[model samples]
Target: MSLGLRTLWGWTRRLFPWVLAAIVLGLVARQARMVEWAEVWVAVQSLAVSQLALAAALAALSYALYASFDLVGRHLTRARVSVGRSLGTAAISYAFNLNFGSLVGGLAMRLRLYTRWGLSAPTVGKIIAYSMVTNWLGYLWIAGAVLIWAPPRLSQEWLPGALVLRGAGVALVLAAAAYVVLCFVSRRRQLSLRGHSMELPSGPLALLQATLGGASWLLIAAIVWTLFAGRVDYPDVLGALLLAAVAGVLTHVPAGLGVLEAVFAASLASDRLPVTEVLAVVLVYRATYYLMPLVLALPAYGWSEVAARRRSARAQAVGDAPV
Candidate 1:
């Protein structure tokens, strides 16, 4: 009945479905012989020093993409929060996104930080919304490029598959772009969505913010793809990595575990890439991109939580000491 217990219960409940989904996918992969344990081990052991260096660089790029959120948030609010504070908040959000499954938790944390810096609530909401728009638009750009340029690398018989993918990718890009435009054009419109107030960010400034945000995400994809090529067995760098990036977004599972692997496997598999190579690629990609960041994030998350608790305790004590 305690708040702590309730929080724990809530997290467990939310996690159960995703955990089950992962188990089902794992079982299916096993049945299909999609996993070769030997290849996984080899991939891990075969990683060279150069590959490790590349992985580190890629991680730095990923962190750089994350910093854009804080940059944009501060610029939009025109607040006095320093770049260092923004970067710290960004790191905290990255840690949250890895553990908590969605950008919702991370965005909420960012909003809270802005609030502490005296940003208006509505402005913070607008900034966050635009930020999402930016990131999604950037993703669409890469997806579009992949769909158009990638099919030539696959077999002619797979033409229909390529077309279907391209169509879907194009649709996703247009839909996301349209949403941002609508929100921008209708900013002055006060509306209710199921009784919740909705404010539109219909402005040129909003568009600019979204554009910058999208560019930041593209930089992140470049980092991962750059590292992924060196670390894995996939032959088609641009196409395969683009598909993996798209899967990362669509999967919505924390860190895009199942979805990314499944897409990475399928994209390469469709091109008749060997299963052994596919597993090698996926394993290395996951190790450097997913696992390593998680390990680093644990310590960062611990430090942030400790600092947050201290700040809260101090505020509470100060409130209680007043006459």
Candidate 2:
């Protein structure tokens, strides 16, 4: 890309979060003239406390599962970071990644934690790459399966025909499978693209990453479904979550502020499940999965930093005592 085009693209990504929020607010304002805000608030209030608790439990499990992504990365990089520390760092960064933006959580947070643990910048980058691939690969696998076998019924025909969707699903599976195959056969697991060297894990490790990704996505979908109280089928809920996931990434909205509500309200709401209720469910889901984890991560991050400093101090003392 040329300089001008690249600058415009950067600006677009940076600004889209605010733009998306504005658009969402504008739409809500327009709808407020027609829909009763009181009804929406009532629906939100109607959600059971038990349902919210269940969502919170599921969110905890999902967070635990995702921390393994960094473990896989540590394995790939052969970093000396301990298992407990790696998992804690991953959990903390992943939480921030959801509540904040990738710039803060994924890159900066991961870098800060791992570097404090004494890993080089390149080693940290490898770990981050491993975790990101694990995330997206699994998403492609599960999303492809869902789209092929049990695509959600959208209220709007904004996308192309069902046949095209199925075709896209097939492509997704093929692409994911191709990745595994290449990891199996390629002698040199590293790839150099645009001055960046990406190292792929072994084929078996790649498959493990995919499994972690698929399970994490499934848990997240389940959390959302639990909040919704089965207003839609599980498949439909999963599809809506996937659609919102894409929108969240594209918009780069912090904590997906309005993205989840807008997407779910538009995509999942039907004659049976009203838009207001869908919005309500999303609000609770965000509270459970996004906000709660972020709050917990603050303490976890502080402890990790403290532990890293102590470990470093001990190592320095031992080195100085040697004769």
Candidate 3:
């Protein structure tokens, strides 16, 4: 086989899994009857400006938390990239992640921009890795908080599911921390620290970043819950949110698509919130998290594409010109 054909085959191999995952998720969503477009439209229309604003704030908070991870990663690597660069990449990457099933699409976009800014592949890889790690650490933080706060927030009868969720949260936290320590210890200096001129500090500052990063994610969750404060009555709003998060992770679907809806429905139904309301809240969440970010991303994507093509064309013309 030709080298070009082999490259094509490899690309196809990479895409097959995403295609398969999408197909399976679509089938499950269909069977689950999770999508009722008419109802979703009604819920959307009923939303007041206040609720919409809260939802937007939630979306913004989520993005902020994400961007914070990039900032933390940059600091760790001692990279001189500006916060604005981090924010731009976060927006573009998130937009792609929401629409496309694979996180790789967004990561690819990030890598390209960072490379254009003179970042090396190892630097890019380390930034991406640290950002993801910090994000998950935030999940552990929220989960732990929900477990501790749920019982006090709600009645004793409502504590069972909360307990189960709390247990899971604690387990995830321990596992994630253990994994990070192992990676740090095993990799040592071989670990890609990016192109930072300064070495990452070991003690207090590192601890602070991880802690604040986790707190930022919880703030995002609070923003989401605030949007539908009166619409749904889960025993523990925070706990349910975290549970939905866990379900989303388990689904491995981008933006937690069907998985979020399924887990949300099951969790709310257990708490006796109406199916219609659960669907409503979930739809609102998606509108804020997915649709809004996507609309915001279009212009940035277009500009980036145009700029990139122009650069590519100039490079090619220069290469082909008579010397």
Candidate 4:
């Protein structure tokens, strides 16, 4: 790459997250204008304490499962960090990611934390790559199964035809299967792309990744289902959530703020469940699952960062001191 182009690219990478955040904030503001805050508050207030507790518990479990993503990634990358540290990094990074979206929230946070823990840039990169792959592997598995078995009614409108949805499901499953096959067949377990060499985890590790990733999605779906309180069946809600999640991710908006709501409101709303109720449920889910964790994570992450910097400074000073 030319110097001018490389510098431009560097600046773009640094600035992209902020730009994305601004755009998402604008979109969220627009969506907020459409919502009835009073009604949403009433719906939230009306929720049973037991149900709210259940949802909170499920959300906790879902996040714990999310932490496992990093655990698996650490193993795959052979990072020497302790399990507790891995879990903390995963939880805090995901908490940020859930609110700030992927690029700035998750990846940036992980890069900072893992690097501070003595991991090289390449190792951290591998961990991030593995975790991302693990997440999507599970998403494809569940989404494929749900689409094939109890295809959401909304698919007919979003997709070209019923058969297309089925075909897509089959393709997704086959793609996942192919990854497993590659793990088994390729002894070297590596891929080379554009001068970069990437190593794939062993078959057993890959299988574990798929399992953990898939379980995380299942638990998350359960959380959503619990929030809905049987208003809709599990399969339908899971399918809708998967679709909405994909849409939200594609938008590159922070936490998929407005994009997620729009997709869920469109896909999950029906005669039996009004759009208002769906929106209310979504609001509660976002607050509990996304915002709450972020509220806790920021301070904890800040402390860790400060501590790491202090340790670094002390080490440098000690090295410079005359004996």
Candidate with more favorable, higher TM-score: 1 or 2: 2
Query: Number of the top candidate by TM-score?
Result: 4
What are the per-residue Cα lDDT tens digits for candidate 1 across 134-206? Answer: 6666666556655655542444422347678778768866776676677667745554666655444446655
Q: Estimated TM-score per prediction?
A: 0.68, 0.85, 0.72, 0.86
User: Which candidate, 2 or 3, has the higher lDDT?
Assistant: 2
Stronger candidate by TM-score (1 vs 4): 4
Displacement of residue 261 (Cα, Å) in model 4 is 1.4
lDDT against the true structure, each candidate = 0.61, 0.84, 0.65, 0.81
Candidate 3 residue pairs in clash (backbone atoms < 3 Å): none
lDDT of 4: 0.81
- 67, model 2: CA deviation in Å? 0.8
Query: Any idea what lDDT model 3 has?
Result: 0.65
Candidate 2 collision pairs: none
Q: Write the per-residue lDDT of candidate 2 for residues 147-249, one digit (tens) a residue.
A: 8998766533335567877888899888889898889999998978789988878989888888899999999999998888876888888987887787677
Candidate scoring better on lDDT of 1 and 3: 3
Report the Cα lDDT for residue 181, model 4. 76
- In every candidate, how many clashes are there? 2, 0, 0, 0
Question: Candidate 1: which pairs clash?
Answer: 134-214, 184-202
Q: Residue-wise lDDT of candidate 3 within 1-323, one digit each (tens)?
A: 99999999999998876765565466547637755557656765776788878778767877766666777667778776788887787667766776664455457877877777678877876787777766676667556665655632333332345567568657866765654565445534334344543234344545655676677666665665766676554335556666656545545767777666655555554345555566677778777787788888878878877987899899999999999
